[model samples]
Target: MHIKKYFGRMLLLSFLTLPFIQGCAFFDNYARIWVASGQYGTDVKDLIAHWQDYNISYAGLSIENPSALLFDTKIDGRSITYEKWVPVTDENVLMTIVKWL
Candidate 1:
């Protein structure tokens, strides 16, 4: 009986989390955008405004002074690929990203 109850709970948990797990890719991008916006003192709307520019998207952000600006870009007919930035500050972040794009 205990084993059956545990299995039932596990199944319920799986069902509850399935949607989030399935949409993780989309959510992850939003999360990265949020993080990047906060780190670079930019607005989420502003960052998202440029999301479709050159097929570039916010990828990730580091939690340090010299943060790594992660972005997704298409290359050579390939799927979107993650690219890294050499450490930069808020002042030059946009310029660097624009240059990269």
Candidate 2:
């Protein structure tokens, strides 16, 4: 029936996506490196690079810059921790993530 066909399609889709989800976790550091690449950000990426250069991995990154810069991030370490608020501006923008290694 249509219900069975729909269920099969959903199951197939789940299987296809599961690998990408798992791959991201297995290659978490790659994500950081990609984000920190100076080629991507003339300013904001530099800030991220600074953190990476120090081997400081953050679990989450929050940026608020209506007209300037306000960065809020959580460190990813033995224990996830929130870092102090950072305020600044760099005209931050990730050019394109498509070619990111």
Best prediction by TM-score: 2
Q: What TM-score would each prediction reach against the true structure?
A: 0.26, 0.27
Question: Per-residue lDDT for 77 in model 1?
Answer: 57
**Residue pairs in steric clash, candidate 2?**
none
Kindly report which residue stretches of model 1 are placed more than 4 angstroms away from their true locations once superposed.
24-101
Please give the lDDT score for candidate 2.
0.44
Native RMSD of candidate 2 (Å): 15.8
Worst 10 residues of 2 by lDDT: 92-101
**Candidate topping lDDT:** 1
Give lDDT per model, in order: 0.51, 0.44
Residue by residue across 35-64, what tens digits does model 2's lDDT show? 334654545555556533332322214432
Residue lDDT tens for model 1, 1-101: 99999999999999999888888675555646334445457543565455443343333443333333444433445554455634333434545554444
